[model samples]
Target: MADEIKIQEIVEFLLKHGDGYDADEAREAAKQSIEEGQPVVETMCLQMLAEHVLARIHDPSWIISRANEPDCEDSELLKRLLDSGASAADLALFARMSQREYLSNLGCILDGAGLYDTPSLPHEEFRIFAVNDEDQPTAMIDELHESLGFSGLETEMELSRQAERDSDNAGS
Candidate 1:
């Protein structure tokens, strides 16, 4: 019961302040929650860490500074950049050319990179039904992704497909 309360408090805190809170602050909060016996808090902390890393990766100035460091090996820098959402082409350009040249060619590199095909993750969507009028059998079917503030259209389609499969299996 105590653990449940702590988890609920953590969830409420995240829902209330997640957007406004920096990754470090969120991480600290998650840590405190963990120390309070909330094992699930680690998941939130990991998410915050990923967000912090991605934010750093997306900052152009940070990327430039890291790229310009002479002591840093190109492979190490490339790996970090990739993990942060840098395209493979960008890393290739960075490896082979001077920073100035790389910057000058960035647009072209991106355009050319777009020509290569890449596999995308499959989308899944799920819905929750809230029945407001039981007599009329009317329900509000909320897409799971939308309720979670996710970009839901693709996920909804995927989930709908999965639900169909599950229903078919159940019928069989």
Candidate 2:
């Protein structure tokens, strides 16, 4: 059987480097692990550190639909529904309903609400899975893939740059 995994070491490593990767701490951890005959522990700690950094760098919104514009197709459908006599409760239901059910009832829901002119608004499913897998000490990549709900996903790496750009755009 494999050596028992060290939870305290992993937690300490995560707490020390979860906000960002620290080369010195990583090196020290590796050195200590080697001295203590725990090479596997060192490898696990490094892998976890990399995954934590990746998750922090990527924007969660990149996986979701952009906010709908007021005059966009969906909003127009909503407007037409309101005009045709759909109650606020109906729209609220539409907003909260599952994507599959919402699409299935789209036409009837709109028509019954008095909206005949507007086209059907397309819906996309967005799932965000944040997992802390307990089976492996260095399961960061697995957790990230599970959280992202996709395999081999590409993500922007410059979060700070993106934030700066967003602030600039907002100010202008």
Which candidate should be chosen as best, given lDDT against the real structure?
1
Question: Which tens-of-lDDT digit does each residue in 142-165 have in candidate 2?
Answer: 453355342321232355578789
Q: All candidates' lDDT scores?
A: 0.52, 0.45
Each candidate: RMSD to true structure? Answer: 18.5, 20.3
In TM-score terms, which candidate is top?
1
* Candidate 1: clashing residue pairs, number: 2
- Model 1 lDDT, full chain set: 0.52
- TM-score to true structure, per model: 0.29, 0.22
lDDT of 1 by residue, 68-90 (tens): 66665443544577689986656
TM-score of 2: 0.22
